[model samples]
Target: MRTAATLGPRRRPVALMSFVAAATAMVFGVAGCGSSDPAPGADLSPAATTAAEVVTVRDPWVKAADKGMTAAFGTLVNSSRADVTVVSASTSVSPMELHEMTMKDGKMVMQPKAGGIVIKANSEHVLQPGGDHLMLMNVASPVKAGDELTFTLTFADGKSVQFSAIAKPFTGAGESYDPGHPSMSPGMSMSPST
Candidate 1:
């Protein structure tokens, strides 16, 4: 029965203050419910969702070279629930391509990988000498030993991941131009000597 309108003059301020406080508490409580905190079972870790977050390069290293062409090796690890395909690669040092070694005419030849390299979910794709690797063509500067080169790998989904790899002296896998594949320019190396 003690309505605000019927409150005494001395008690009217107290009643108004209580009403204002309750309104403020309700407003803040509603806002708190809609905060940015993730819901239960939601993944918020660094390894959670997104191609850039779930994909990582392990033990990345590039072949040291004074100029021309070289290759980079690493283990592409995918931690997501879906597969990620690397369509292309690039760096300030040179233009890069995803390459793979295959047996051609009884020779192990390296060529531009068709459809790119796919890193399966919860698995790893190794890029090693005489195997799948990232070829850096027409390097402008020398990639000296202990030099760190940054690279960007663009995925099929338009998502990209950036990583850095150290350069190391590697004389193995002497690659030569494939004469059978005349389409490849003379400047390109297409065959890996087995």
Candidate 2:
């Protein structure tokens, strides 16, 4: 059989390009098959903190909504010697509050996290949909797909970090809202925060 070694160097570039194209197409095709939600900003690059090296935020993004409530999702990693608590957050679109969703009596309920979010030292905290996330209540302007929102997180130690999140349209109704538990079935209902 004529192997790649025997095919000579001229045909190598063509074979490589074809292989790359096929791989890229396969990746996109598989990603599209997972959920009906648009994956436009799913591949956003994680951003780092410029103010402090001990804390780093990654994969920050916001859900697209017209004028109501929405949330910011991301991962917060703490590499410091002491624990850090995110006391509050502020955004130009609306007022921000730390909220969490959970399964209560076979229903998903959203509530305000009174003490805010805590990221322990040498550990990571994930702020995502159906879990502990930053809430944007009563948004003034419309947040459409491909839009960016800037927000700043203030810690208890008076240190703050600023980041931007890309807004993408999403349907969070189907999420189970169970933090760290995936065995539960999809579909979560949220009640007004108390």
**lDDT of the candidates, in the order given:** 0.83, 0.75
Q: lDDT per residue, candidate 1, 70-181, as tens digits?
A: 8899999998878888999999998878888888878777778889999998999999988899988778999999999999999887889999999998876765545555
TM-score of each: 0.71, 0.62
Those runs of model 1 whose alpha carbons end farther than 4 Å from true positions after fitting are 1-48, 180-183, 187-194
Residue 60 accuracy (lDDT) in model 2: 92
**Sequence-dependent TM-score of model 1:** 0.71
Among all windows of 10 consecutive residues in model 1, the one with the lowest summed lDDT is 185-194
Q: Report the CA-based lDDT of candidate 1 relative to the real structure.
A: 0.83
Q: Alpha carbon lDDT of residue 172, candidate 1?
A: 67
Best-performing candidate as measured by TM-score: 1
Specify the poorest-scoring 10-residue window by lDDT in model 2. Answer: 185-194
